[model samples]
Target: MAHIRERSLTHPVPELRGHGLLLRPWDAGSDAEVAEWLRGVSDPGFQQWNTPLNPVTDLAGARGSLRARAENAANGLSASFRVTDASSGRTLGHIGVNEIDRTFRVARVGYWTLPEARGRRVATRALVLAAHWALTGLGLHRLELGHALGHDASCHIAEQCGFRAEGTLRGAMFEAGRLDAFRDVHLHGRLATDPAVDLK
Candidate 1:
């Protein structure tokens, strides 16, 4: 597989409308918003969307995470972004495509919206935008999203975006609080060829 890192894509801010949201790259410096958003996330199920970086309880930690994200992008691994209100541009959530494989044109997509952002069709719009960018702008063939089976909301988002449910993983995650963290996630995905998948 040719490494996706070799593709060297310039992250583009994608525009998605019709569902009252916009999906775009995280601003050059958005640590404050990142930290504040993380703090506001009080649900354990939603928090699983992030990697197991040490918990960020302060702005400094969020800054550190942003720095690390830049480093990762430089190394050819991930690209992250924020989901916002199209009209107001208020940061409502964050999402990203990670573990990119250029040869296969595959990447793992993940995201979570604020509690206030939930049930507003924000995630659905953001995810579709990400997929559109991946399959067209980035020339990717496959996009995958995995969510703990228990997190029905996330799974629902993936499905609503036209990703077909694949299967479940077992004992693949360790969540916060030693709470029997197992990945056991249901995988949802689409290939660029699927007519329903927005490969535009």
Candidate 2:
């Protein structure tokens, strides 16, 4: 198989502001950010939904994860951000556009909110903010999101963010637990031509 190198982003990822949230790059040095990520990855709900594949066991691993996120953005493979409360500067969640195909102008979006931040529509707002930036700021034409079939909350966040349910992929995702176990995933997508739904 031939490897194709796509054009990378020329500029740095910018900070995005929303109604009550701020989307900023992950801070590898911030204690609060590290603690928040550790808390999130430890939550049962987050572990089930995100299926991190590998566990983040300690603060060092969490910081390493953030560093890797920065490298991915630098290489233009992905752009990830920590969603924070604008007023308190507390980490609320995270959202990102990964698996970028610059040649095709497409990417996959993913997000997860901390337990303390759930039920407040944090994921929806963060997703909307990131998707808009990808579509407009980065000039990407398509963005896709997928959730486990039974994850109603994720589906709702996708829909509210203007991503239409495209279909399902049978056994497309590997859920943690049993070896070689996979779960069905419901796919959703949004195009550049799609009318942006108001997040306010």
Candidate 3:
């Protein structure tokens, strides 16, 4: 297949609205935003399948982490968004299209929902919106999603967002809470041309 000429991603990534959810950039200065961010990152559920490079254990660390994500978006290296309710504006989760490669027209996507937002398909809705923006507005040729093996929820969300199951990546990521331990990852990918899946 011929490569679709990719376009440059805009600085200050645009907010995505749909599926009754809003995918917007993290507000580093807002106290509420920072608090919610801290809560999400510090949640035990988040720590289960993922190990962040720079962990956020407190409010200060949350602010710094949010700043770093904003910086990454500014540098065109990645885009991280806070998932929220479109109408209520309540913080629901976080989703990011990271490790963007402009030359290769590809990027990896990841996300987590807040405990209060669990069991409502919040992550699935957020991923669908983010994937659409990354593959369409950002003009990426492909998007990849990976989760620690056994993260069934993440695998389901990827499939719901049209990301096809590719294969297992052995020891692809650091095991939760331990850098020395390695965990297998289930890798999934979606091309820009792939048909969209229903959000329901």
lDDT of each: 0.68, 0.84, 0.88
Q: How do the candidates rank by lDDT, highest first? A: 3, 2, 1
lDDT (tens digit, per residue) of candidate 3 on 64-182: 99999989999989999899898999999999999999899999999999998999999988888888888877889999999999999899888887999999999999999988989
Query: What TM-scores do the predictions have?
Result: 0.80, 0.91, 0.93
Please give the TM-score that candidate 2 achieves against the real structure: 0.91
Better of 1 and 2 by TM-score: 2
For candidate 2, lDDT tens digit of each residue in 85-166?
9899888988889999999999999988888889999998888888888888779999999998899989988989899999
Instruction: Give the poorly placed runs of model 2, Cα more than 4 Å off.
Output: 1-11
Q: Give the runs in model 3 whose Cα sits over 4 Å from its true position.
A: 1-11
Can you write out model 1's per-residue Cα lDDT over 31-90, one digit (the tens) per residue?
A: 657665555444554655544646656666666776676666666577776777868988
Error of 3 at 7 (Å): 19
- Per-candidate alpha-carbon RMSD to the true structure: 5.4, 6.1, 4.4
